[model samples]
Target: MPGSTDERRAAGYRPLLFSIAYGMTGSVGDAEDLVQDAFLGLTRARQEGTEIVDPKAYLTTAVTRLGINYLRSARVRRETYVGNWLPEPVVLPTDRPGPAEHAELADSLSMAFLVLLEALSPVERAVFMLREVFGYGYAEVARATGKTEANCRQIFARARQRVAAGGQMIAFRSSPPERRAEGEQLARRFFAAAAGGDMNALLGMLAPNVALHVDTGGKAQAFGKPLAGRLPVVRLLLGVFRRAGILGVCLRPAWVNGRPGAVKFDADGSVTGVIELDITDGMVQAIHSVANPDKLAHIRLNPNEA
Candidate 1:
């Protein structure tokens, strides 16, 4: 294995595989599974000595095919998904030097953008992502998804129109004076109070229309569905924090879906929960909480543990 070129090629599959799989399956868990399968496919192809001259191109096509196939059936499967199905939230690594490249990756991974993609038909989504996110030409996208050049062009145009027509607008914008500050202050106050087990203070921060959505994928313990209204949200969070205990959880500012976000840290300062807030008019509109154990693998602390 010292100088094997095959090993190097295999190592390179993850970046493309992750992109394709994530574009296909909005769920990070599903995207990860698909990436594993893509690697396995590459491995088996190598075992048979298929002589992949352009490894990157081959992996791209293979992964795209797999993703497109999955998308063709994903709608049927997702119909049965519990609660309002949403894309998994991720903490994007932004240390990359090239601003354009980093921004593209970060933009593609946003929960807001992914949610917008949900409205697109599976084939349309594939064409749009392959063309837009990966910088593939219409003909190249066509080959990857088994569509004609004309069809790919049409789909891309339609997707562009949809985006321009506001079906897929960026969920948030550059924070202006009318937004961000007051909203963040309120969220910080609420999170601080909740972490301290102060129900009264927590309730005071929530708006009358506050809604909370917790996603644990049923594999982790969390609110089963989105809880709506201030009373319901406040009550639910109260029960949650009361049981979770005061572990000195602190909320730190973060960007989620290009919007204001916060991370909850345990007593030892390990992130445990990542919350995406939908703020309107400086009031908390909606809350999407990601506490799935699998999703929180990067999280180093437990809310139940100090």
Candidate 2:
């Protein structure tokens, strides 16, 4: 029902809406579907002759509520999931420029941050993301979430405490330019060490308490539980890469969820897996690997010479 002007405006807001939805629900497909549903709701409202003073706010609210509902349903499924649950990886080109604002956005999109968010309840996650990540005021968050301003504040406070208790804070602070450069350099060394079977070099780059989490969803082979400690993780990774090498699998350096990572491709050029490294203090703190075919459906890569 929207005219050309209104349609164009709504289209322009798709990126922001997608970000919010994706932050709320760490699944790219769900986020995109929620955004489409929000726009469809807007169309219905306009067709009903309802005047919208601010389409952005309206659509945001719709998407948030929809995401909350979706999470309420998804939480149950996640409980009985086959193996370690992980968000679908968002891969980007390594050469992409990351300014300050972009870095902050990247932090929120990281696999570690999204995994941390799983601790909060649906409304708590929504309130926290609106206030802490997106910088929405209490009143704005209240209107978007259908809660009073005071209640929204309380929810955000509780969410913050929960996140902090998890040993991480959900702040939008960007890493220093030098620190980012160090992470990139470390990631390169990490992949090189693994490929070359340099066990000592790989051990040197990993944190003392480094943890590895692989999500295969019972589709591909992976550990039943999160593997902890430096030596075991290193051993597992080396074995996996060694086997992959025998099968003509290729590893391509990429940016996964804003962190230095890589994508694995099969001999036929199909995506086999994605790996994201959480680097801190110049060491790899966490290794997140996703091999579930369902989650890898969105990742497309051109065939490279094997």
Q: Estimate every model's Cα lDDT from 0 to 1.
A: 0.65, 0.84
True-structure lDDT of candidate 1: 0.65
242-263 per-residue lDDT for model 1 (tens digits) = 7656555566665554445666
Could you estimate the TM-score for every candidate? 0.65, 0.93
lDDT of candidate model 2 versus the reference: 0.84
Per-residue lDDT for 1-306 in model 2, tens only? 578998998788887787788888888788889989999999989999999999999998999999999999998898999989999887765665433323234656778788889999999999998888888999999999999999998999999999889876633346678877888889889998998888999999999989899999999877798899989988988998898889998888777777889889989889989999988878898999999999989765543421
Worst 10 residues of 1 by lDDT: 93-102
Error of 2 at 239 (Å): 0.6
Candidate 1's C-alpha runs over 4 A off are 1-6, 92-107, 162-168, 171-213, 216-260, 263-272, 278-286, 291-306
Which pairs of residues collide in candidate 2? none
